[model samples]
Target: MTWRARLLALDGLTPQLGDADRLVWTTLADAPDGAELVFLGLDDGRPCFAAIPAAGDAAPRLANPQLWGLMARLPAADLALYGGARSLIDWHARHRFCAQCGGDTRLAKGGWQRDCGACGAQHFPRTDPVTIMLVEYRGRLLLGRGLGWGEGRYSALAGFVEPGESLEEAVAREVLEETGVTVPSATVRYIASQPWPFPSQLMIGCHVRASNDAITLDTTELADARWFSREDVATALAGKGPFTAPPQQAIAHHLLHWWLNQPATA
Candidate 1:
């Protein structure tokens, strides 16, 4: 019973397992020293681990492709595991020293925590929460484009949740701040969530009802903001519209797809 190892590079690419049906696990004796190891639970009673090599050191025969490119190409389960692995590896790399006392830190709790040598403080990985909402008003959805997203790329409005604020509160605040559309607390509804691991973020998806269709775009935050009807959105999703929506891997796209299929209500 060989334990499976997924050797990930600093850039997040893993070794391709050739045409073999399963991964080729490198035993502890074969793993390189200073490689960050994380136990990723078990697959069919065999232990599965994610290994990240030290910076500037190459892993054996692994391709160095970008992780974002593999999201849609890999199976859902595999993608989820890779997301977790990438996040944990990134956290460890960034927290090599403790912030409290500027002391050295070492891995603890099976790669989930860091222990300080000087200050004796324990540090843990952080996951920032963000609220992404699809705002609706008068049978239309509000979309906005960030400053550098090119001419016609629009998606749901999102912002990080501030301290001491509820999810509903964050939703309303982000909507107003980015698009100047006022959404009351009662009209905000939670839909679903997705783990965004670019550097560890939990995206909370919601559908918000705007009090009015009027939009006042904040130029510093957004390049453009507008309300799109269901017909327009459907056309965009079908790749026939003037503007393009988010990609399939994003929660924004999922929220839009869900909203497009719902029956209109008074």
Candidate 2:
């Protein structure tokens, strides 16, 4: 059976298929042929996977990419919930130490909290804020190409939230810092969110109205930057662009898709 997309959320995770204990740590196991493992991060004593091909069938299946690609297909609720589990598990695996003092931390409260043995400090899982926005002006969207991505691939502008700022402020600051475009307060609208676990990030998607159209590129962050009409964006989404949209599973892609489907307001 074709695997349907399910979000990773408190409500998204259903009960286990059976009472037999499941493995949490990564292990080498012999998966039956034509099966794909959709790894659900560990919670308390359980780790889950939406084991595809429940029984016997013959077809080529996904490896790791196919597993992660599941995010794009799932609803925001499910993605947020499932990604939450993944992030929590990942944080638990890494935060075995106290940053305040060189102390060891022990897992407590079913993998949610880490208690320090040396200085009595408590640590929790983190969700690093990321501002992902579609900067709009004159019926065009601002796009950028990152250094690490393939050539001719462009997506919405994005950056990390600094120490003392809200999500809207981060969107404005990131647009200015990366592309020298000023985003207005009235136009910064929240869209959706996604769990990006390259190393634990919560990507907050938004639509921003730019005060100016001209771009001043910050070479360290973006290789190239420019404005594209909705038509141009539509072409790109259709896989005909010199630059393409981000992966369909990403919040960036969702923002862009929504923008493309809307009537031009600016």
Candidate 3:
């Protein structure tokens, strides 16, 4: 994978595959003169590293994105490696200076940490916790499309887990705040989670049963919200109906799959 700026998870990137459809990587010794090298890890006894350009891109765009286009083509293991590299390198680029004492920080611990020389402060990569849920009322799933999503595309609702809040609490709070759907915290069920590489987020997936079905959309977060029937969800997943599903790489897609596989009485 090649990226000029590695600050954002959705930043512009194009993967390079050579020989037998594998990711093309360069060693630190062969890196460009101005490149920043971060130790990624060992792959089959040899150390892996990410060589980043010194002057990185500041802004990221989503128009005609190549990474998204090539995501499904690369092997799952390769995609995960690229995501990890992006998050680690991005953390380094964004934390060049210490936030506490205005001190210059140097890369330490093989790209896992930063140490402030002036203030003796240590900074580590941040993995923000986020709650993403499939809100259900009766037998239908709640889905919404954000302003930035493509036409007719929708996915599960999500929000950051605020400080001092439990995962269930955050889920209930976010569902209420963004869509005016009251989810009882006790009813929120924990599902599998995915590490969202968009600037490093741990997406905690969950689901809950809602008693009411009315929606009062928070325009700032969602352009529209509605309860989708089980059949509507199945059609969307098949890529031919009520709405388009979220990208396969996203947890939302899996959440929908999980929902469809449950027993009829569940």
CA shift at 37, candidate 3, in angstroms? 1.5
lDDT of each: 0.77, 0.69, 0.79
As for lDDT, the candidate ahead, 1 or 3, is 3
TM-score ranking of the models? 3, 1, 2
- The per-residue C-alpha lDDT of model 3 at residue 162 equals 96
Model 2 regions more than 4 Å off? 1-82
lDDT of 3 by residue, 74-135 (tens): 67887888778777776777788899998998888878889999999999999999999999
Give candidate 1 regions above 4 Å deviation. 3-33, 53-66
Q: 33, model 2: CA deviation in Å?
A: 26
TM match of model 2 to true structure:
0.72
What's model 1's overall lDDT? 0.77
RMSD of 2: 9.5
- Candidate 1 to truth, TM: 0.86
Error of 2 at 196 (Å): 2.2
Global local distance difference test of model 2: 0.69
lDDT of 2 by residue, 1-266 (tens): 12333322221222121123221222324344543344554444455443322322122221245444555555654555555555555565566679889698776764567889999999887878898899998898999998766678898888999999988889998999999988886779998887786457888889988999878999999999989998898888888985777877677877888998788875
